[model samples]
Target: MGDRWHVEVDRSVCIGSAQCTHLAPAAFRLDAAMQSHAREPEGEADEKVLEAAEGCPVEAITITLVGSGEAVFPPEE
Candidate 1:
């Protein structure tokens, strides 16, 4: 079994960049407003998901551990 992750997109900071969708199609999608959204807020941790978060132009995507709430993408500063 793999670790679970919680994915989130900050719409307010998001710039409708399709980078995430392009990077992780199975994990992200764009709505009518062109805002990025997580296909699965909580799901098995995946390399593509991490890639998507890293590719987000505005750094709007955030990923964290499902159980411990530990930051995954941006990491703790």
Candidate 2:
């Protein structure tokens, strides 16, 4: 996809699982506290990033279109 996306990791909901990091090391990272964070808040849409969000056990990872602000993961209901 050529579109851009915005990624976020809800630290409060993250459990230091590192699933995001494991799935998309280029898109996600874990601090010393093990809390997950988006490597780039906004970047080109990537399949690995989506995979990381989908694989998150707590669903802490959220992704949306950068310009449209449309939900990309956990899709709009």
Candidate 3:
């Protein structure tokens, strides 16, 4: 099976900074409620999308690989 990524955002923690949107415009976007949301990319997954999740100050974004169920996150500092 082809590789796929599942992205999710913790709306409770999203601060509307729009940083995710700025970083990965194709993967992250703002909803009608001004909440941040992570969507599956149309084609191949971009490393920058993961970077955006890492850059989120609130750590609200998370990315997981489908099937394998592996997840990635920014290092805790």
Candidate 4:
């Protein structure tokens, strides 16, 4: 998983909707703070990860290439 993408959730922006957890259970988990976190971004496929992020109501999840630090989800508009 060294070369795979990484996921991060902005705690301030997250609203504990649990949508990401529901969409990609293997990759996401609810933390003690009741925020969604990416347990293993590679646990699911790229598309699945993307889908989970897309379903986040607060748009708190952020996906990026591990080495490049480039944003993969919530892409610039």
Best by TM-score: 1
For candidate 2, lDDT tens digit of each residue in 14-45?
99999888889988889999899998899998
Clashing pairs in 2: none
- Candidate 3 wrong stretches, greater than 4 Å: 41-43, 74-77
- Deviation from native of the Cα of residue 15 in model 4, angstroms: 0.8
Off by over 4 Å in 1: none
State the number of backbone clashes in model 3: 0
> Which tens-of-lDDT digit does each residue in 1-77 have in candidate 1?
88999999999999998999999999999999999999989999999999999988899999999989999999899
Q: How far is candidate 3 from the true structure (C-alpha RMSD, Å)?
A: 3.0
Candidate 1 vs 4: which has more lDDT: 1
Alpha-carbon deviation at 28 in model 2, angstroms: 0.8
RMSD of each: 0.6, 1.1, 3.0, 2.7
| TM-score, cand. 1 vs. native | 0.97
Model 3, 28-70: lDDT tens per residue?
Answer: 8899888897766333556888888888989898777766657
Candidate 4 lDDT tens digits, 1-77: 34467888898999899998888888889988888878875432377788989999989988887767777888967
Q: Candidate 2: deviation at residue 35, Å?
A: 0.3
lDDT of 3: 0.77
Provide the lowest-lDDT 10-residue window in model 1.
49-58
